[model samples]
Structure formats: structure tokens, C-alpha cells
Target: MSAFGAWTTAHGLPAFSYTMDQERDPRAEWDPILEPPTRRHAVHLGNRRITLVADNYGLSGLFDEHTALRWLTRDTGVTRVGELSTDISGSERIFGPTFVIVRVADDQVSLERTVLCPEGEAPWVLIRLRVRNLLGEPARLTLTEEWAARPAQVNLISGTAPSTGPDEDVGLELELIGGARPRRTGSGRLAVPLLLAAHGERVVELRYGLLDDTAPSFEGSLAALRDRLPRASAPRAPEAEREIPWHAALLTGAACADGVLGGHTLDQGSCYSFRHGFNGAARDPLQHALPLVYIEPDLALSVLRNTCAWGSPDGDLPYALGPDKQPWTDLFRPSDQNLWALWLAAEYLSATGEEAAFREPVPYHPLHRAAPVPLGEHLRRQFRFFTDVVGRGEHGHVRMLNADWNDMAITESGVDRELMIAQGESVLNSAMAAWVLPRYAVLAERLGDLVTAAEARKLGEELRGLVAEEWNGRWFRRAYGPGAVVGDSDMWLEVQPWAILCGATPPGRAAELLRRIEATAAAGSPLGARLRWPVREHHGPGGVGTIWYAINMTLIWAAADHVPELGWQWWRRMSLAAHANAYPDVWEGTLSGPDAYLAPETDRPGRTWDLADLGIAMQAYPVANLHSHSQPLLAYLRLLGVEPFSERAGTGDGARFASRALTVGP
Candidate 1:
């Protein structure tokens, strides 16, 4: 049995295991034994990530390490026999629910280890190991941890070593009930040795902390971690209890403090780092907060409040918020940051029926800021920055002075008084305005701010009209700059879907628009949809090209705009694209999540890399990459002729803030 299964069975839970039989081409680098635990085999409790694999390799990631302690020498690190075999006493076993424990037994001994991470704490991982000697003679074992080095310093303190490295800091400390601390056995090698009597058993635990807060006493931190062990190994309830799909539990969990995340893996580490800036990018965290509003309301509120704390008094949300709660404005003035903030607030209010949360006093404000205002006032400040401050382009649409959602869409335009420039009017931004402004109006009206509600409704209508004008029957254009209309040059994929979502498309036209989108944007590939069409050359990763999972998700979301069945079809396609068998011989991802993007549909030889098997495209939140995957639920409800937020809005849907209002769809 796997170590996880062993633990689960030991705890009275039934264990189930399976293996996929497939013929492998000798040239393919992917090893069947090395496939990261299938999603089902992985157990993630809160922010703790524990995955069980079939071999002593533990997890085949950049920072991956097998659990058991081995004998160490000056010349060699850890010894390994190729693959697990059935011969003699040699075999690998897996354990249950989320397979997080693995047991490997040989003629000489049996060893098992369980991995876990605790919630709302330091980014730390814990490994618990149990070993029993099988030979008649006593044996001495040396436990070793190996990962590629990223930073320079390694400190050992009270069995708690906090190491600082580049981009991220990592600390690994070994704790034993009555054992010796790790000693430097050879050049750059650290290990702890223990001798076991014939047929004797031993247990040891290792704790790893990322971004270790050295300020705390080591004993205190160690005790806190120890307190969490029972909860980690306990037979916890499934994520399905929250009404989410089992497969999507990881996405929702990671959005909050309860999820276990692999600490940032550096270039020097063994596994590729899927760094979607934790300290940077206002949009990233907000995207994570989207679905979280539905599942974990308080966590959602915390994310919103913390982000707005870094907002400038002028109403520009910072592109990056530092740990000090300060804003980083010099890198780029993100054009779309404020919109995401507003959307987050609206979604939270809609999902939780909590107007008082908005009315609560603002918890944070940057330096030179005025006395604290209520959250509602902060939101209005952001809207005013949008209306009175950030002016429209020549086409009367929102300007992409710095950059919109597409960071690469930056222009050479210089800055203005607001520290923003007018590069062009983006249809995507304008459509987003049209879609979200009315929602904001709904929110304002709910909060009894009639004047703000009227203003938002008026602006939303005007922007919706402009977006409609940009739709030339076949597809909506991308944007209009100082002298030219983009996407009119060639049908681009960015703006049309948003037009449908925002109700800018005429009632009878949404379905046709979706059909046209499918034909053009997804024309080249069978595996999935491309981000755009007519691949604009020499634009770097830009133009109507490349298969980005983000764009595909948006398109699927658009598909659900009116027709539930259509939306389901696209959703199924997206899910299938992530599967290894979905392709003839290639496995896209080692785990059960979509890759960042597939290779360009045109490249036959390199097409194999498009699947997640390439490793570099591995991401933490693929489901909510560009926009939150929760968007589809809203669309699905609409197709069923039910307004998602209608129940939440209640009878006060007309003008008053009700405790249970829902978004009404036409």
C-alpha cells in the first residue's frame, strides 16, 4: 500500500488503487512511474500540499524529494535502484483518499512517510517517516534532503534552519524525539545518522518553512506545527461539502490560507516554479479571490481589503503591493487594476449578501492618504478615478494608456497628469466597463447611493453603445488607436466575447457571435481553441495567435452566455485537452490540470510540447488564469433562466440593499 493508504487504512478508511496500462515509445522522456500522483492520488489539506508517487523519488518536481533516510558517503549523495520491481521483497505501496503517503519495502527493511502542510501559517511542509528494519543484523541509516540551490545562506538553529535564497527564502529543519541533529557528512552534504537494532522500528519528522519568519522562537513554531499534525492526518471531510466539483477543490483551496502550496521553487530548484506573482500583480490575487467569494467569504474579503490598502489616494490600485503594505508604482501603471478591484467587491457583495462589509471602515491606506473612509467610499474613489480622471480615447472607449489585461499590449505613448497615457481605446477595456459598470450600479443602488448609481448606469449605457458600434457583424474589433482600428485589419479574438458577456451584442446576435468566434478563433486546432486569428507576425507573443488557456476559458464563458448546452460542450473540451490520452502519443500534463497553452496549431514537430508534459507551463491556478472559472457558473445559471444573484438581491432588487440579492439575467 502507498504510505497515504497505509495511514488511511490505519485510521479506518478504505484504500483504493489503480494503474493505467500504456505502451510508451522509448524516445519519450515521460516515465510512467514518474507521473505525478493523479489528482485523486494527491491530498491537499488547506495550504498543505502532499502528493504520493509510485517510487522513492517522492514527487518528480524541481524541489521534489523522496521521504526515507538512506546511507550517505563522502562521494555519493543518496543511492537509488532504477524503478520499483516486484522481485523478492522489493515493492512500492500507495495509500488512500488523497494519496499522500508512500511505503517502499525491500528485503532489508520497510519505510513509510507522510507529507502535509498546515493552514494559515508559515509556508511550511512536514514529512513524517516510520521505518522498520527487516534484517537480522543492526543497520545504520543517514537521512538526506537534496534540492538545487537558489540562494547562498543556510542557517541551522535549534533544529530549525531558516535559509534565505533569491526570489524566496526556504528553511528546512529536522526534528526527532531523541535523535541527533544533522551533521555535515561531506562537501555540501547534510545528514543525520541513526542505528536500528535487528527487526527494530524508528520514526522521524522533518519540517520545512518557506519565507521563514525568524523572529519567532524556534520552539514556539515547532509546537505550533506539531499541534497541526493531528488535523493533517485526520480523516477530514471532502471539499465537495462546499458544493464545488471535486476536481476543482485545489483551485478554491489555494485562494485562501487553508490551502497547501509548494513554496516558491527557484531556477536552481528541481521542480519548475509556476510563479504567478504572490507579491505582485493586483489582478492575480483578485482572480484567485473570485470563486473564493462563493466558497470562503471571509478569505475573499481579506484579499480585497489588503489589495485596496495599497491603493493610492488618487484611486489607482498599485500594480504590486509589497509585504510592507506599500504600493509599487514605478514598474507599470496597470490600466486594468482598478476594474478588477471593483469586480471583486461587487462579486463579494453579490455572493455573500454583505453590504455592511463594504460599509465597514477601510482598514488600510497608503502614506499621505486622508483619514480612513468606509470601504464604499474607497470603491467610489476608484470609480471617480475611472470617470472624471481617466478619460476616454478618440473612440470614446476606455484608454489602454499603460496596459490592459494583456500586459504585452503596452504602447510607446508617454505619461499624462494622471501618470497614465492614451495609447489607444481598447474594446476589451470598454466592454469590461460596459459589463461591470451596470453591475456596479446595481451595487451602488443597493447601498442607497442613488446619485452614484445613476452616474454608473449612464456611463455603462454609453460604453455599451460604443461597444455595439465596434461590432461589424462578423466579429468585434480589438481596439482603435490614434490613427487605426485594430482587428478590423484582421478579426481579433479579444473583444468579441466580452461584447457578448456585457450585453453589448443585440439580443438575437449573441449566439451568432459565438458561432463566428468558434469558426475564426479556434479554426486551426482540434485539441483546443487559439487565442486569436490571422496570427499577426512580429508581435512577439501577441497578435491573433497561440493557444492560451486563458482565452479558451473566456471563450467557453462566452459560450455559456445564453446556451447552457453550448457552454458545457466547450467546458468538456477544455477538460479533455488537459488529459494525456487526449492526444495520440503525448501526455500534456503530469497532473490533472491544463497546461498554460498549447503550441501554435501550425507547428507539427513542436506540437507535442503543447500538452502540459513540457513542464515549464505548469501553473498553480490554471482554471482561473485570466478570469475566474466561477464565471461559467453565473452563465450556466442564466441559461437555466435563473438570475444567479436574484435570490440574494431579494425584493429590494429595485433600489434597496437586501440581504440576499442575486444577479438578474435577461
Candidate 2:
């Protein structure tokens, strides 16, 4: 049994086990796993198992190991997995009244199935499905099935068959042998039978193979073939996470939709750190702060520190990292660049509470005697850039304030300006540096250089002063600020409170900002977070808007620090947004033309990394953990309730502000 396993044992859920029979290769030439999802829609065409939601109302678009691989290809959004079909002879599928179908108006679906092999290995799959409901409701009811075969090396799943070779044994059958059942014979491959409530569904699952290996190097895979599914069948894993390597977060509420997600893994540690910024550029520093936000604190903090080191002797950082450790992009947004870096590092250290760890040398850029990343030099240069340079002409921040990308604001718009300075301004950077400079100064003091500590104190005070002076515009900006105010980012402040919560704003302004934020929150569209006071238009880059995914991440931090009870509020809003938006999965932007709004389409480049990071970022929420949160849920709730570092966000000085409301735009 696995450590988590225990039926008769202490720590186990009701245990049901299974074993499979030996099978002949149908064809060495044919791949087994069928269609893989181009994006994380219910559509599947790769080597992944899937499961479906019972209520069709929640997470109907989400995918799990049981979502039929065949259905994924059909371009359909189905609530439940159908029983395996018997007549897949031609292109047509088996249909029925109880089944769900994609609408004809939304004919993006084509009933299809395929066999896929993952990296040419042991676990293979075969799936058959049709998309009749993805674009809209369907004309006829239809469902697909998939057969997935995997040969796992570790068998991390307890109560599952041990890793005996495929040739060595036929599949193992788990029997609900004795005890209570009126005498009856359950035959064929052995298994557990779960009685479903009328019109209700339950997750049927099994994890096999962990009984054997412990090494990461172990190689084993699944092999599968499509058979007309069994009687009254459930579905495949129906979840995308079963196939993609992801960490998940969780949310719980009755009104909540089926899928909830916190974030996705962009790099190993970063979550939501843009893989590429404006003009498709990416920053390496985010890997430490964003990716590792919820997973590994020590490693994440290390990434943040190293990123800070990249600040040049003149105090600039490489725009992005190349494969060769060279800077990739040249355009840097000081708001996103410096401030985010500082916040992330301090966030990590604050999270761990192991101040002692701060004394050590960070990775890649260091020599124990004297690391070259001299803070004094870099800080001075950065100070000059923000206070002195950057710009003031036609496209300057002071001029454009609400402008898109680097153009600044000319158009009146929504939730981005206070957001801009709050993210970039001197105070945020100072606040972050405040934490570090002092620590480093303390280290210097301990090392007998009290003078450095004194200097550090000055820097800290300066940074704090900057915060009080700027980075404060409350509520969701109705537009940009005073001098450089863009008529567009009409100054309201839904996003302003986050600045206060994140420490970009001064503590005194928090209550006012919080109150403004609460009033600005949109209540009508479950999916749309109002861009401003009146809530007229949508706000975002890819055109789809940023509220849905962005809020999932930020809210978790909200719950993590000030209010765990608020998690339900976050989930309700996001869940409703997903449905109000009605996307099979998220889109790069909202759709206005001939296509479905950013919903996943065949061969489309997707926001995979974002989804992964959402899961990681959710760790602050204290609702779900790394293992429990996955798509479509975790992507929507980056603040998984339970996490590795709840110690900080959950009960720190920040906790004092939980009940307080923040008013930013006064």
C-alpha cells in the first residue's frame, strides 16, 4: 500500500485495486494514445486519460485523464464521458438521447479518433470522439471513448499492481470479494463497482505501479486500444493535467463551476511570469519569483536573488534570457522590470521566514568573498533612471500614463495605470529593496561594518518615503492619474488595493483602497471583473481581457494574507467568469470576429505556461495544495488554500490588514 493508502490501514481512502492482463501489440506501426488537446479544452488527441464532470454545469470545458481523447478532437464541450462505443467502423459515431453533442452552428468539431504514442514509449493510447457541442449546444447527443495503456516505472500509486513487466502478467483485477454483497459473481477483469446516484456521478479512479520503483530515471509507459466502451461507461481521465506535468490548487464552494485553477508552470518556479512581455519578450528573473511562488520557496528565493544580481553595474537588468545566458530583449518596462523583481525576492524571503538563508551567496553570479552584484552601485543607477531618465516627450509615462504597451495613455480606459506605477514606481522598488538592504546591512553589521548597515537604513527610509509619495491611486482607476493622466485608464481603482496588499502602497492607505476595490468589483457578469467604476468595457492586451486569469492569481494572495474566508469570493467570481465567458479553455483575447472568443482551436499556440503557474501561485490561498489543484479548477484559483508557505501570507504582519479596506483614488 502507498503511504496515503489505507482501506483497512490508518491513512487510506476506501481502497480499490486493479491489475491488467497481458496484451499483444495491435500493431507496432500504430500509435496508441489518440488525439491530444492543442490547448486544454475537453478535446483530446494525444496520449492522455480523461474524466468528465457529472453536472455539465461546472467545468464542462475542463479536461481530466478521463475526458475521452476522441471527444477532444471533435471540438466539443461535454459534461460527461459516454460509455465506450461499439460501432466506430465508419466516420459516424454511436448516438443516443442521454449523450451530449456539439451544436452545428459551432461545427468546429469533427468526429475523429486516433492512436498516439508518447515519445515512442510503453504507455500508448487510442481514442474515438466527436465534437458536436464545443462551439455551442449540439443537435444530437453523442459521446466518445478512449483506451489508455501505461507502463509506469515508479508505481507511485499504492494498492495498484506492482511493476511486473507487461509480458510477465495479464492485467490485475480488483474484486469487491466478500463482506456485504448478496451472493453474486463479478467476473472478467476484477474491479470495484461504485453505485452512482440517479443522474449523479462520482470519480472512478486507480493509480498503479508505484509498488516497484523509486528512482526518477525509471521508464515505463501505458499502452491502449479503443474498444466500443463498456456498459453505462464513465469517461477517460477527462482532465488535461493527467498528461501535462502540472501542480494544482483547489477551491471549494457550492455555486463554483466545475473547473478552478490557480496557475501553470511557465518555468520550474514561475507562475504567470509572462513567458514573453510586450513584443513577445520574456524575463528570466520571473522564474524565481513567479514560477516558484507556491512550489519551492528556497529555490524561488534563489531565482529572485540571482535575478537582482543581473542588474548591471549601471543598474539595468537583461531584458530576457537567451539559451546562452545572454540578454534576449532590449526593451524593458521599469514598472514590470525592477519592481516585480524586488517584490518577488522579498516575497520569497518573507514567505520562508528563514532570515538566516539570506546570508548565503545566490546562484550563477557569485564568489563567496565578494559577489560582483554590488547593491550600492546598482541601486544608485536605478535611482537615476526612475527619478531622472526614462522619458517625458510624446510617449513618456507622464504623458501616456494609460498608454498600451510603451506608448503611454492617450485613450481613456481601465484598471492599468495605478497598476502601472504601483508595479513600477520608486516606492515598490524601494519597499522590496527596503527588505533586502536592511538584511544585507545587518549581515554587513554582523560582519563588523556598522557603516554599511547605517547606509542600508537610509536606503530603506528613502524607499519607504517613495511609497508614501507615490504608487497610490485607489479603487479600479476610472482613468490614469493627475499630471500624466490618460483619459482612457479613467481613474478608478479595482486593482489599486493589490498594490497596498502587496506593499507597493503605504500601509495607511490600505483601508481606503480596499473599500474602493470592493465597490468597484462587478457583480453582474460572473466572469467579467469590471474594468472601472461603471464597468462599461473589457480590459486586456490579447483583447480578451485580463480579469479572469489575473484575478485568480491576485485573489489567492489576498486570502493568503488578510482573509482566508475571501477565497470563496475569488472562486465565485472566477468560476462565473469562465462560464459567462463560456470558453472551452482560455483564449489569448476575447473574440469579436468570425471565430469563437479565445477558445482553444486545433493547432493553436496556447497559454499552457499560464495555466501551470496559476496552480503554483494559488499556494498562498490556503485552500488547495500542489497535488489537489489542477485544471480546469487550479488554473482559475492560483491561490490554492493549502500550500508549502502559508506560514508567511497566512499569519504575518500583513494579517493585520485583512479586515481593513483600502481606498486608493482619493
Go through the candidates in order and give the C-alpha RMSD of each one to the true structure.
Answer: 10.3, 17.3
- Model 1 vs. true fold: TM: 0.67
Clashes of each: 33, 176
> What lDDT score belongs to each candidate, Candidate 1 first?
0.47, 0.28
Winner by lDDT: 1
- TM-score, structure 2 vs. true: 0.42
Best by TM-score: 1
lDDT of 2 by residue, 1-666 (tens): 211111121011111111111122121111101211221211111111221211111112112211001111111222122332322211222111111122112223333321212211112121212233233433333332222222222111121222323322223111222355412121212223333333333322211211111211111222111110111100211122111111211111000111111111122111111111111122323422343343334444544554555445444555543322334344334333543443454445444555554454432222123344333333334433433443222212221222322212223333355654332222223334444455444444544556655875666555444444444354322123334333223333223434444354544455454444454543333443433344443332222222434433444444434444344354443432233244322321111000011112212212221122222211111111111222223222133332222322223211111101111110
Taking all chains together, each candidate's TM-score versus the true structure is 0.67, 0.42
